[model samples]
Target: MDDTLTSTLELAADWADRFAELTTDERRQLALWLEESPENAAAFARMRRLMSDTALIDAFDKGDAPVQPLAPLPELRAGSSRPARADRRKPMLGRRQAIAAGLAGALALPFAGYWLAGGQTAGSPPPLRFASRVGERRRFTLPDGSGLLLDAASRVAVDFSEGRRHVLLEQGAARFDVRHDPARPFKVRTPHAGMVALGTSFSVDHLAEASELRVFSGRVRLDVADQETRVVPADRWALVHGATVSTGSFDPTTHPDWQSDWLDADAMPLGFAVQRLARYSAAPVRIADPKLASLTFSGRFRLDNPRQSLELIGALFGLRLEKRKDALYLA
Candidate 1:
């Protein structure tokens, strides 16, 4: 191997060692490093795969014991499409094969970058887009010291220029912890409403036909498309739909706690709860009985595992759950 490739592999190994302990700044630096070259990304992927192995993890957890490296990866000739059928069955990994696997991992990084940065290229300029898939949440910092938390199945497009920082919430939900910047106001634009904040912490949920805004701290000005502008203070929320804007009270004790990975619902409709849960659920949850959709549910549910949460909800409501190949039906 060349000196550059060897150095990159060593760096990848170091990152794998500290992957779980890396701070936000360290993660940013790692992202920047991956952006430097395709080789670096490939090397990081190879090391990450190795670190994620069940045997390696178990060994690490068992204490300071040296782990026996598993068999090396399969080999492929230069300009080959893929390994032959016989080679695919082989489990051994040679030194050259290991290096090639690292390169393969690097080649996959660009596709993985979509989920990491909402489709935005790391260390790239704006007009960037970001998205989170089902059963996933992402937290990242903006160039302006602002922090953003994207809920599952959420998407947003960002544009930051000389004078303003603008974001369009395309779908799902997101929380913004804005940094104080008097010169450039932070604005979030939804389908039917717009929000402007000077320095505040707020969350926006833009689901089908409805957009809800909740202010956790500081204040925000809500501008509905055809309604009067309203100032929402801390502990308040506004719901916008079509041409109507309704202001309501916000009780943190009962609202969905995204920060804690819990959904604390108080008399929330079953349909709405299912809708929210669907974002984080791998399988589609369907209500077989239309009337049951209006039933209200109140409780705190974990968001990390949607299937378990659904089972709990089913038990609470005494609802029957039918499992099929494609979806879960509740009645």
Candidate 2:
């Protein structure tokens, strides 16, 4: 093999072993590398298939297989037949190849409340669920190169089957930077809305009474019950409440800053802003004056210090803050 092919295969093997464990930045690097060339994507796919093959996993489990280095994978071209096997002699697996295979096999074992009741087939991996508590955030990448940034008080379920990537946003908010695959559409399903993206970066915020979809780049098709599909383009958003779909503009810079550990409000209602801050607050925030709830305020507050945030809000809005045993009241 040439130097380029050898390097590509090595990188593929490395990713196969540590894909699930990669940080958000590391996953972004891998995604950019994959987008650099069609050949890279194909090579990575081949490496993943070899690593996940059940026959190799079974052989590894039995521990009686011949100890030989793995043969170099044949170079494949689009629409061309796979090269025939070199010979019947089994080659020993390389260290990286061995590690990838071992990891794949180990992942097949049941995880706590992650796997379905029945065992999953060898070809299909079990669904993985992720969640973040109040004031906490999480970031991870899916198998298909898509990345997710889950905000505070959020939960998501990810499933990648043969031809689709499905994600269920149970609550709170998440941002998705999706990898484009025409063969498989990335779909995010929320309680009040569903979004389908061919390739896009977007955010979904699901609250108790409504859901919001924001498109930062590319286009998204939003569907609400019995309503016409709303196609939202870049720098736009839609709010879905019951069966109503309301579209609006969103400036990326002025958007909520929860991902950056800040709550940003641009002339947002005081009640709504307080509710948003409550997600990161240690104590409940109450508005003693009902008339003060609709007062609009614009500002950015740090999520790490809820008390300070409340203080800033009080100073800005000229409201009085009262500390109680059960809650912080602002009148």
Candidate 3:
């Protein structure tokens, strides 16, 4: 019931939101947090459990929180491999008890997804994980007939159950061509503030703490954490750089396709273009400083040769692009 524990719980909740789409640097940071103290690890574990326990929802729906022993989760509506299980059965801190432990404010935070979970709270489908090689791009067809185009070095997980279709872009970028299903909203999740598509065609690119979203076919309802959700008109793009939000319009029909060698960007960040070029490299490509992103690139460039493309980008910004130990760096 101390203030420290409560704050840690809140922090853990935010961390939980990003767990599905952590970048390499984020994973390292999480490891460091877990290593800070046993309490930190325990708090994170409880939040993770809270995310999957539908019994907690049942308790919340009723007038009281769960006070009983850990109960089994209902079978995933259908197409799930097996029933869900809960392991923390004992005298436990239910939501009410958690509130008593000074967690009321944390629960009230602007984490709508934490509460709704895209209608998959009752059951979780067996995850189907997919990843592309550093220089390879791949396409997939979901059970729901939607199409997923993963960019080079990207990874994502798909879950298709009776009521919902969820895609977790763990790292890298992907284009989603979703089939319209009102009953089952097609959503893409990331730890960042935005992402989650519905009946539309769009692409999401993630690097470090920023995310970029480009909509091609349908309008997208954009969510900026702790802010109101805004409607992004079709043929527009949105950017979340730290606390700043930038958006602009583009010719959706002329949007750059990674499949093609050249990408025509109109005032896109230098980091984003480099990230795409790095994907085609034989080794890892990284940016030395986030400040370098301040310089923007606004033209077409050949992507087939990553080395040459990287040099061109570096030269334009007056920064050096170098290779160190088989990894490429642009500063």
lDDT of each: 0.70, 0.71, 0.67
Candidate 3's C-alpha runs over 4 A off are 1-123, 196-198, 288-291
Residues 226-296 of candidate 2 have per-residue lDDT tens digits of 98887899998887867677787867876656767777776656876676677777678888887887787
Measured by lDDT, the strongest candidate is: 2
Q: Give me the displacement of residue 230 in model 1, in angstroms.
A: 0.5
Candidate 2 ranges beyond 4 A from true positions = 1-126, 253-256, 286-297, 314-320, 329-331
Per lDDT, what order, best first?
2, 1, 3
The deviation in Å at residue 237 for candidate 2 is 1.8
Q: Model 2: number of clashes?
A: 7
Per-residue lDDT of model 3, residues 65-177, tens digit only: 52232222222223332224445434454453343232224343333233222323334434666678777887876667788888888888777766777778888888888
lDDT of 1: 0.70
2 or 3, which is superior by lDDT? 2
For each candidate in turn, the TM-score is: 0.59, 0.59, 0.59
Writing each residue's lDDT as its tens digit, candidate 1 over 109-200 gives 34344322232455544354667778788776665778889899887887765578899998789999999898999999988789999579
| Candidate 1 stretches greater than 4 Å from native | 1-126, 242-244, 251-256, 289-295, 314-318
